[model samples]
Target: MNKILIIDDDHGYRDVVSIAARKKNWEAYTSPTWRNVQHQIAEKKFSLIIADYRLRNETIIELLDYMKREKFSFQ
Candidate 1:
């Protein structure tokens, strides 16, 4: 099954996305903060990552740069 990661602080949004993904038979995971999210990314491979453009901890650009520096291949 396809795996997906949904990064957002909003619980409602996460729930909605998770439910949607489940309907499509995809494995869905969520992380509310960047600190915890990094471990998830390192531990698993995701087919898609849906993140909020503005996180409470960092902006999307910062997150992208961190992913690039860590060599986390999303593509």
Candidate 2:
């Protein structure tokens, strides 16, 4: 099963992606809170990430940088 991490502050956006992933039978997890999202990512392996270009706390580039710095990889 493909594990997908969706990072978005917008509830509607998250729901839309989650519903789409569900239709494809993929396991999708949503991250509304940035802090908790980090913990979740650290604890699990996600095949892909769907993030908003702009977030309340940071931009997508910064998020990608953080993931890189942490040596997180996707398959």
Candidate 3:
């Protein structure tokens, strides 16, 4: 099964996306903290990444920065 990474601060969004991802037979992982995102990406590869524009401690800008530094590919 394909895996998806959801980077968002809202629980509601995560839950809704998780349900949809599961229904489509994909594994969904969510993270609200920036630190966890690093670890998760390091440990597993995700086929897709859906991120919110804003997060608790950082914005999507920082997310882009991290992705560039880590060379993570997202669809």
- The sequence of per-residue lDDT tens digits that candidate 2 reaches over residues 1-75 is 998989899999999999999899899999865555887787788888888888887788877777888998776
Better of 2 and 3 by lDDT: 2
Which stretches in model 1 have alpha-carbon errors above 4 Å?
Answer: none
Off by over 4 Å in 3: none
Cα RMSD of predicted structure 1: 1.4
Go through the candidates in order and give each one's C-alpha lDDT: 0.85, 0.84, 0.82
Q: What TM-score would candidate 1 get against the native? A: 0.88
For model 3, what is the C-alpha lDDT against the true structure? Answer: 0.82
- The alpha-carbon lDDT assigned to residue 51 of candidate 3 equals 86
> Model 1: which ten-residue window has the lowest total lDDT?
33-42
lDDT of 1 at 55: 82
Best of the candidates, TM-score: 1
TM-score of each: 0.88, 0.86, 0.84
